[model samples]
Target: MSILFQAYPLARAALFSMDAETAHEVTLSTLQRAYDCGVTRKLMHEQPETPTTLMGLTLRNPVGLAAGLDKNGAHIDALGNLGFGFVEVGTVTPRAQPGNPKPRIFRLPRAQALINRLGFNNLGLETFIANVQRSQWRQQGGILGLNIGKNADTPIERAADDYVLGLAGVYPHADYVTVNISSPNTKNLRALQGEDELAALLAQLRDKRAELADQHQRHVPLLVKIAPDLTDAQIDAIADLLPRHGIDGVIATNTTLSRDAVTGLPHAEEAGGLSGPPVHELSLGVIAKLRQRMGTDYPIIGVGGIVSGKQAREKIAAGANAVQVYTGLIYRGPALVSECVQAIRGM
Candidate 1:
């Protein structure tokens, strides 16, 4: 536990000194090498049982590593070894993309938060699948969620084409696939969240999923990732459309466009989605509203601002069926996983 917990403050001190994007690459590459050489398990604290079921998938625990951190699915095995019940990867597009320019990711340590407008940078679906095939997570029964998105270069009108291409390619490799339309960095992407466009997008993917399920003789659940900036009426409208579209689940949030939580903190005015502590309340509010509208059976994977076990509990109490983490993993290290597991079960 100390190895997982105590080592981080110094490591974070070093990481925070460098540019956020550089630090991200360096850390992930290190973890990947550790995983490749078979020492990844040593980095994690063993977590207690906190089994959860969502979208017909059985998770060892409800705590998962959220999408975005392992955007290309490059380090799924290493991340899986860190104690996440599931690890969701990618906002991967149909083709490789360099994403936005450098200085795209910023840290606000005082707020225990981060803001990034990475714009779905990835190695495209082909390389992403090859990496997934090379990983040990699936062999070890770690559930995987593959998140898909349209290319930054793709026209908003053709977005469904990219999503369909992604669904077809990843369906054979994924436990589930998330449709990511909520990322603030993607230009006009959130426009898809509007009523008519959302219905059209979901309709295209639903048809593609049905075709893929038959071809693979397997079924993969599709979950939509939504934003925190939505009004109550917009959320309700989307909720009303979910079951009708055969959308199996929803991830309550990606990140927030709202900066009200951070006020005058450093980089608080950065042009990207705000994450960590600032996102918690908005995430809870979204979850509560969605849970009420989606009703008891629909799945919601709650995310945002989960720095400790108590916040994890608050997400569930707000009606999340399962929860995921990214920024908390940054602040608290792997011990956050065990802490969250313990905290949630005790509740």
Candidate 2:
């Protein structure tokens, strides 16, 4: 634990010095190499206590490395060993494309947050699946969720096709799949969250899910990842739609465009989705609102701005059955995983 704590500042400094996008790549690459050399496997073996289950799938722990961190499924095995119960990869599109541009991701160290408009930049669906097929960490029994999205240039009118394509391609490999319409970087993508559009999209996806389950002789749960920036009315609409569309769960938030808590921070004005401490309360509010609308039985994976055991508990109390962490991991490191798990165990 002491060694892990000591590594935090050094890792932060090294990654902090580089451009945010470049630093993300560097960090994944470094982890991949460590994985290849058998280091990360050993870490997983050492962290054996970090395991839990949700949504009928067993997770190594409740805290997962969220989507966007390993968008292409490149580091699942390595990350699994890092003690995450699950590792969600990709806002993967049917076709790969370079996202926004350089300087698209910004760091707000003081706020322990990040603002990224990295518009689903990845090596496309085929490449992502190939990586997943070749992963050394297969059969770890940890939950693996593929987060699917439409390409940026894809028109919203035809966005359901992209999601269908993603569903068809990823259903066989994923423990579950997430439909990500919440990201702020994609142009007008969140408009899909509107009543008519969301209803249509989820209905089509559920139909596809039924088809795939029949074809593959299995059931793969479909989850929707929503944004923290929603109004109560918007969240309630989603809750009402979930059962009708056969959706299994909700990932209660991707990130927020709100800069409320980080108002005066260095990168406060950066144009992208804001995450970390600034989003904690707002995210909790969304979870609570969703729970109220959906009732106690609805499963929610609460994310955004979680940084401690107390915060994780707050999310559970608010309505989440499980939780995910990204910015919190960046700010607090792997020990936060164990802290959260221990806290949950106590509860």
- List, residue by residue over 198-303, the lDDT tens digit for candidate 1: 9999989889888888999988999999998999879988999888989999998889998898989989999999999999999999999999888888999999
Stretches of candidate 1 exceeding 4 Å from the true structure: 42-45
Compared with the true structure, the alpha-carbon lDDT of candidate 1 equals 0.90
The sequence of per-residue lDDT tens digits that candidate 2 reaches over residues 143-239 is 8899999999999999999999999999999999999999999999999999899999998998899999999999998999999888778887999
Model 2 steric clash pairs? 50-60, 51-60, 61-85
How many clashes (backbone N, Cα, C below 3 Å) per candidate? 1, 3
Best by lDDT: 1
TM-scores of all predicted structures: 0.97, 0.96
